[model samples]
Target: MCAAYGEERASRTRINPAVLILGFKIHRSLRMQQSNKPEEQSASILRSR
Candidate 1:
């Protein structure tokens, strides 16, 4: 959905490609951080042991 919106924005505007790509990278990292949250919780628990 985010990608779809990005595509739409890209087509509808004259935004710079580098900005679009950077936005995509930021979004991907945010998504990855969300998915990794649980794993990080366990790792923190272990680290405290």
Candidate 2:
């Protein structure tokens, strides 16, 4: 959705391609971080052993 939104915004507005790409990258990282929380929790528990 964010990728599509960036495409639409780029086509409709005059935003820089670099900015759009950066925003998309940040959004992707945030999504990945959200998904990784459970894995991080498990890793932390193992590390405490």
Instruction: Give the candidate number with the greatest lDDT.
Output: 1
Expressed as tens digits, the lDDT of each residue in 1-49 for candidate 2 is 7667767767887888788788778788877777668888798789999
- Across residues 1-49, which tens digit of lDDT does each residue of candidate 1 receive? 7766777778887889797788789789777777668888798789999
Q: Per-model C-alpha lDDT, please?
A: 0.79, 0.77
TM-scores, one per candidate? 0.44, 0.43
What value does the lDDT take at residue 47 in candidate 1? 92
Q: Which residue pairs in candidate 1 collide?
A: none
TM-score: model 1 vs. ground truth: 0.44
RMSD of each: 4.7, 4.7
lDDT value, residue 26 of candidate 1:
72
Candidate 2, residue 30: how far the Cα is off, in Å: 0.2
Residue 27's C-alpha lDDT in candidate 1?
82
